[model samples]
Target: MQYNQRTDFRSREYNGRLNMGVDMRQPQPQAGSVHNDGINRQPMPPRAPKKKMGKWSRTLFATLFVVGFSVFLAFFVLESATDLFGLNKEDKQLEIVIPEGINTFQLTGILKQNGIIKQPVTFQLYAWYRSLSMPNKKYRAGTYVVNTNYSYDEIIYKLKSGSTKDETVNITFYEGMTVKEIANLLEKNNVCDADDFLEVIDKGEFNYEFMQMLTKNELRFRRLEGYIFPNTHTFYIGENPTSVAKKFLTDFDKKITDELLERMKNINMTLDETLTLASIIQKECSSVEEMKKVSSVFHNRLASGSSLPKLQSDVTINYVEDNIKPFLKVNNQKMYDAYNTYVCEGLPAGPISNPGIEAIKAALYPENTNYMYFLTDKNGKYYYAQTFAQHQKNLAAAAKAGAGVHGTTTQQ
Candidate 1:
């Protein structure tokens, strides 16, 4: 204690450098820290602690996952139902039948079962979509043809309409053909039986008022004889006779319009009378111009007030004869039937054959002429006569021209 050491660095250095210029009272820097000129750097920030999952949190996560998966599945199902991807393309020919009074679901099931449709529920949705575009859309019951190559829209279109893959036939009925001839032609074409057609034409009661006015007794021979209005007609291959006859009658009603009826009334002629005279004029003349002239001749004779009121049309006489020949003999010309213009006065009972529009117009409005008689030669050359003497001379000329007696009979 009496000999204490000196605290000064100079004294320590003299004592064999024991202190070595160090300070023992200063604080030290921590590990993993750098000191640059007595300045210390801070460490990195601490990480956050992980939270524990509770029962409610786990339920919420699971619920969200299930809802997302359900939405994805529902979208896939809807796309398939609408055929949005256009996947059902098989290109196979299929025959499908839908019975009467079936709902959309039943029809869809049937289509799917028949392999016509791959998805029933999807087809139902497709049908619903199609119905929106149509004004009145309803699936018809019938045998249908479905081609797999066709789109769903096309198949729905065919099903909505009653269109089917059935055999079709076109029957062209030319003008001037009689009802009997038409019946025979129908039978020959396998459209219907001749007897069935005749029966339907005779007994069928149409809704048209013009046809209604003409009773069974008023219409001679057949009720629908000259009213068929010959033209090209199309029908199903296995159509019924009554249906075919109805089509003909319907066409006739449309062709003979109300304006024509008014015109006939203005000319002091009934529908039956006009059709009858038109039929006679049609058979008498070979051409349209000749028909007008022949109609004039008949008009003159009717208005002539002569002792012989009979038309004396040779065709009318031949019409009543069985087995019509090219040349009618004098002996064969005598017929006791009311249709025989030679024996009967005025027009015949009814139309002899179906007349075209030209003949009908000719009968309705005859050409203005004073001529009372006309004759057709073998060459189809018509000779008109104003008086009896001129008619006799024309007859002599026609006989010299090698015309038959049928030509001579038409002269009177």
Candidate 2:
């Protein structure tokens, strides 16, 4: 029965295979085919190679770039150099004022501001270079009439050469003249404008020792009334105001010798006070001898304290009337009080006139005497008196001698 069971199972398997007709074996591979883990797959396409540039094309491109850059650089340098030379500028006339003591940098700034030059740094460098070649050449301070089209060399030459023969004038300011009169004379001779000269007198910055000793007083008519030395000076036709002022101040600085300074110290008087007294003596006296005598009278009165305080000078009133009143907007009593010795005690607010050397010397070294008053006649003769009664007698005698009797009338 076991042999028959084994033979029956083999017979059943053969019968199932004949019924379905199925194949259980592996298939054969095809030619010209690749397999991935016994499976067929499609192949990928090939990639193309990259293109490269030629040598001649790259060389041409580089040459064009370099040429373009060179052209741009050339144009930039040419424009800057032209500006540095002050060429290619418009043909325009300009008037510029060069301040005193200005350095080269500040001078260039002024030129640039006035449209005379385009580049300040380049102009300064050019100036430095020119200075090395021409050591004597320098820029001057004054009013200049310059053309905008001028080259840097031409401008420098014009400034350094100074004024021409026709451009200079010799003007004389007489002694004892007021600042206003001096201003008028300067304007008439075309040295400078009167207002400009007056403005400089008030606000100009002078570096002299005497100028440094001055105090700022707003009530004074002209701050430098007596300081401007009277002299015959040659000046440019239209000089700078500050330069003109410096000319006068420089002369004053020289005139005040060391001996005079020591004398001022010995007298216990300031430069301002000495100048003020000198101005009064200058106007009141007719001759140098008379100046000393009149100075003694004033000095005597000043030493008497409150007994004879007021100077009572008639010239101060004349100054107020002629110079100050005409220029005032309204009647100012305080202004009159400031300069009129009749109203205020001690010296007038400032010097009434510019004193000459003689008058200044007279004020410093007055004739030692007991004189307290002085009077002048029409003949320019002076008479001195010690007491009020004697002064009245001299005044009467002066009046009897002629109709015109002038001078101080002070009381003890």
Candidate 3:
């Protein structure tokens, strides 16, 4: 064989120097002598066993291997190594529709289950850190589209807002429901803070998040009474407190404006007065027809001028609702608060309760009638009386017509 050519094995020479594909210097063996460079010239001490690749090269390659493994390990920690790159590649735009008012704990669970996030803890930490750093805190509610190809940190940043473009969940509060009741419902499934939520409603405490979006003229309901409109609405999950409140108010006003207030002018009434009357109508009218008829009677009584009291209504007694069962007797005097028509004149300080569409319309366009007094039939239909004596007679007839209503004292 030829003495030398280039190969991976020969990197250095016996001259204590290096070569890059060309030999600089090397020892030559004596002719016919196997142990020339050694004790017996045994091939020059076996060329130092080719340096055995040393610990340094092994260490360098070991380090590179470890680093490559660590990168793979990081992916596994993020999401069980499910291949986020493939996930992102699969669907460039993914729609993750989370409902409104979902708590962080619940939201984290959902993200993991939905495969939107690789690690729940990672997401939680990421969101918390980002939220702290953010100038404006709290996530908004709405439909959103997310891409899954990102790493844990990358995904967290992308979804910091936690809103979606889709509308699935709805956050709603009716005007008539008490704060305790509303908060209880909201916290029932861990949607909102129970104690903190009540603070939001009853205390009128500002939710830092919601305050940012308040319209210039929109009034925040101090008492929260008659503020939350009773209706179903769409809300995105993970919305902050302020956004939740604003959405309720927005929806409430929308309903009232479209149906109640606009038609009020047609009926020669103001918004407050119309709502007040509607509350009464809602309380008094047992049947839908009765609601219309009773509304008419109240209007007629107001027009008569004979009764200067402007048709006193007692629904406010039921406004701050007490069960007042027929058998469960309590002092009649104590129950006669502002809501008692017998005690207070005109509409109670404000609307007794938030009225619905039918009630609102009844206030606007009551059925045409000349009757003054109204009583309930066995089926809760009204029996109107143009005269007081007729009203008394109808009352008796109504009481006799039925075996006395099991529960009484104001509820429609």
Per-residue error for 204 in candidate 3, Å, reads 5.1
How should the candidates be ordered by lDDT, best one leading?
2, 1, 3
lDDT of all predictions, in order shown?
0.72, 0.81, 0.56
Tens-place lDDT digits, model 2, residues 1-412: 9999999999899888878886656664555466547656555567787867789889999999999999988986786588765677898888887766767798888888998888677678887886774586566778788768756755655565443222778999878899999989887887666887897798766777787778567678789989988899997665655667889998999998899989999988888889999998888876887788888888887888998888888888888998889977888888789999988998888998999999999999999999888888898878888888999889888988888788685454
User: Per-residue lDDT for 1-412 in model 1, tens only?
Assistant: 3345444655666555434755545566676566757656676678888989999999999999999999988986875654532354666778888788777788878877876666667777877875665547577888877666544655665666465664568989877788888988987876665766787787765677777656345325666767888889997544556568878888888888888888998988888888888888888786887888889888776776765587888777666663233223444332335577777777777777888888888988898987777887677788988787788888888887794734523434
| Winning candidate number (lDDT) | 2
Off by over 4 Å in 1: 1-165, 215-219, 323-336, 405-412
Residue-wise C-alpha lDDT for candidate 3, range 283-391, written one tens digit per residue? 6665676678888877886676646344545445554444222312454444344446545555554455556777777888888888776666667545677777776
Model 3 ranges with Cα > 4 A deviation? 1-180, 194-224, 235-239, 258-262, 266-268, 304-314, 321-336, 405-412
- Please tell me which model should have the higher TM-score, number 2 or number 3: 2
Clashing pairs in 2: none
Q: Tell me, by TM-score, which candidate is best.
A: 2
- How far off is residue 115 in model 3, in Å? 22
